[model samples]
Target chain A: MTKDDLLIIDALQYVNWNRELFEQAREGGVDAIHVTIAYWENFAEVEANIAQWDRHFEECGDLVMPVRQAEDIDAARAAGKTGIILGFQNCSPVEDDLHNVERLHAMGVRIMQLSYNNQSLLATGCYEDDDAGITRFGREAIKEMNRVGMLIDMSHSAEKSTLQAIEYSQRPIAITHANPSSFHEALRNKSDTVLRALAESGGMLGVSLYPFHLRGGSDCKREDFCQMVYDAANLMGVERVGIGSDLCQNWGYETLEWMRSGKWTFRPDYGEGSAANADWPRQPDWFRDSRDFMNIAEGLRETGFSDEEVRKVMGLNWLEFFRDAFAPASSVGA
Target chain B: MTKDDLLIIDALQYVNWNRELFEQAREGGVDAIHVTIAYWENFAEVEANIAQWDRHFEECGDLVMPVRQAEDIDAARAAGKTGIILGFQNCSPVEDDLHNVERLHAMGVRIMQLSYNNQSLLATGCYEDDDAGITRFGREAIKEMNRVGMLIDMSHSAEKSTLQAIEYSQRPIAITHANPSSFHEALRNKSDTVLRALAESGGMLGVSLYPFHLRGGSDCKREDFCQMVYDAANLMGVERVGIGSDLCQNWGYETLEWMRSGKWTFRPDYGEGSAANADWPRQPDWFRDSRDFMNIAEGLRETGFSDEEVRKVMGLNWLEFFRDAFAPASSVGA
Candidate 1:
């Protein structure tokens, strides 16, 4: 498969979107990327994030193009440009408003997680002890999201809720950017039972490149990341598997610290109107120095994948999944 | 008994304090009252609440005096003044900072419920389903509150954390105002086990006059309110039973809807502000046609409580409980 056939679609990234990063994606052979703009934010905060993206579109139009249709992937690729598919690491920005899903969908958020790493109004986060599956609000959120034809991501969701969501959704769901817990046991990793159940519903499980899911946390080589995918493939077929690097290419350690605190900044009462405070947007330790996109591709190659398999794993699988999952605007249920 | 012997002390009331209320309390023989100046607010909001109290002190100095000690009650009675004990319906104003508790205590906030009717950073409110109990921050808050001699009220606390707090606190706590679950098995009502356990700490339970508690969800009269207290007295003995009327006097249905929506106003993100909007502060349905303080005393008299029993039930029992529970000025425990 040529570079064109191997459309490298990264399902997750939380970069500080500026002209430099947008230009970098164009150079990175990133055929398309799902950029996360929300985590632990409320609806207003998410709106601010979308507004920032609006500025990005106007400023960086030459390099970055927003993807509203699945067909836009080829248009972006043919134009030698990278398509930006907006995603959220958490549904917090929407908070208790299920109605905001359609509004956010209009603003270019195509994918949403039910929760972050703790209990939200909808679903319990993976970190919470009570994994009682989808809450009443969570079920409603799924219905709204399904109706809107937005992809439901269960990457950081509780196991029970993850399975419930895969079953509850009429359309195929996604465990976007996660590793099989059967390969490496971690709080963020998904179990085979859930992975298989997700696959059974024509859902997908995109293997994450986060080092924590590998054999060694931060010390992991790129081959470890590829092997995690092989393990998920062994349990669930290759068509149901994909690559979601969970890449925060330009972000750093300070980001994790901001994520850990319930408040993004010490003094930020609301995240609206500000691009977040200076205290927030701090780089976390993990992303202080990061592996570039080329290294990630080379790493997958070293893990015994053929060029055909690598093509699908890199981006083709996600492209096909997105086309199948998201219905046309007129066919949208909501 | 004389009006002085009645010694009526309202353990909790969040009324819009004005010269009229102060003059009314003086007329009704309210010796000392725990007036809530904070709820669903932050330090800045609490500061504003205190500022309003300062205005009240200036506007109605002849009839009102700040009550810092049990001695203040006696002093106010002799001085022919109504002693005002500042209180908080919720500790959200303090947010997650423990040091803020000291600032609030110094500002004359003597009583605080861990949360309103839902989860805050410190603890879960009664309306929240998960009973994870006192959070790490909540434990720290209790210790700080104990250190400052502020009364730790569990009137709206989750049962799991309430019991945990009862065991954790070095000082005795108060339910301040709540009904027994035996009377009304609602989330708002405490179970008989917690009620009995509260009295075991040499603590007190202030029976609320809210109709939701007395005879289940149905409306109740003054006699039904007396019967609920008698039931508590049967289980907890009369000494541990007192009145915490939760008199939201002059607070209207708009305020109730605000409280119900978890925002102070109908608009989005209406929280984070302490003062009710100028258009707010209308009287609710329960208080619109309710009897006065004399009517409550007469209701107890009609319910077979003797004049001597009336003195304890009205206020003396609460004062003695607070005197023993609250640490002296010098040796507040850490």
Candidate 2:
């Protein structure tokens, strides 16, 4: 399929949303995007974020539409709009209440990460000193999320928690956005063990384009990234791989601080033990914005991917994963 | 020192308080008691709990007084009242903010556990599948708690986290309510490694009296309990030993459910993995209430402890520990 004919879905992105950005996504032929709705927000704060997204849908109706089901992506594609799938980067939106899992799910949060870059009530994050696989509460939360169709995203979770979540969740889970650490040893990147377990469980991994996760950060070439994808596909079957493109577009330094520190500390916590990464690292020239997603498709094709493989990695795989992932456990026959 | 001459301090207890309970403690000759003020409560909820304690202090003025400093324990002794030392069984009251460590310390919360029975932002609890020692936030929290004179309590923390807290804190930490796991394989009990590390770091281990943490549960005899203490004293120096009791007086099964489940899960979570322990296990007949503390001292004497050693085990060691642990890190001189 030609690049234009391919259904492109940037599985995860937290851009400073506006009409310009939505138009930029459309300019890139992106059919759908999973937009992060919360990092450390509590239930009420998450509701505020959803309200903001509601306004975005109202005002940018021509460019974007809310996505609550797999069919919504098709609708967005037919309407030439970018479908917005609401996701949370932390379980804080549920606060201490497990029932809030279904409550948030009813409010259109289809994906919820068990933790961010720190330990949470649900599971250990990648930045914790040790990895506590999953808590008693996490087990119950996973079952509730699975029952209600809230996809478990473990992109920033520790290795053991990630693997356990994969095994424990009756339905397949997703990493949502992260690269393989074997390519570039970023703390946020997944290990080979985690990747294998993820693929074995029929899960999807949206390979990230975040500079810090890249082999050479911003200086990383498109060919290197595509090669990493090729390597990941070899490790985890091509069917379980997709372009998550953890693209953080148009956010400022303050936004990065908020992402890293949240309300957990009064001082700035530069996660991953790097004092040099205080500022947002530069994005690669090949994938600087939502509009640059096509470059990844081209790079994948150049890296020995067939047209079918390129189409699958670019978006089709995530589309299929989402179709199964977004349904309630009973209906999905998990 | 004779038993009557020694200042008796019960290091931990969560009782459904009333004037009668305060009178019972006074009758037990308890000079001070570290009362659990919060467990899984948020900041506002913790404040409400403090308000309730304030009412208890008002109504039971003849029997109890609030103890904010080590001197207050002596003051309670002089005044013939049981000094109430406020503590938290979980760090949930701090709720992801390091500043809350000092805030709650200023509010008379002298001792705070890094976690309850699950993973928290600060540390991993014993019930988790694995232990992720301390998080980056936990390190900073330890410093703040030390600076502010809030004793770091790791009674329910996982092994790695407990050891890390013992090593990381500028001041010695405390396992405020647990016994040696060698004596009883209960999940809440401490291991030899943890016990040795805690003693090597000049920390205190307040051996628990809760039946579940006892080897024989409710059937434990005074001789067996005293023998366990003697063994622990040999394992860890007698200077670092004391009584935390972990007494849960007058609470019903619903309170037990609240403790294990909290608000984190919709379904029941019988922590430490036994569904048969849904209700509070029966307290040992010899030490069923605060008034029974004299039995422990008598049992220790029977186990071949001298007057001084028995006095130290009963309360004097905890009194000295409180003198140092309740002081600011600078004042304690580490």
TM-score for each model:
0.76, 0.94
iRMS (Å) per candidate = 6.5, 1.6
In candidate 1 the C-alpha lDDT for residue A213 amounts to 54
Residues A236-297 of candidate 2 have per-residue lDDT tens digits of 99999998888887888888888998877777778753676588777888888988877888
Model 2 segments more than 4 A misplaced: A1-4, A265-267, B1-4, B272-277
Which candidate has the top score in DockQ? 2
Model 2, B71-176: lDDT tens digits are: 9988989899999999999988987667788889888899999999788888888887677788888888998898889999999988989989998998889998
Position B37, candidate 2: lDDT: 80
Tens digits of lDDT, candidate 1, A72-101: 887988888888888887877665445677
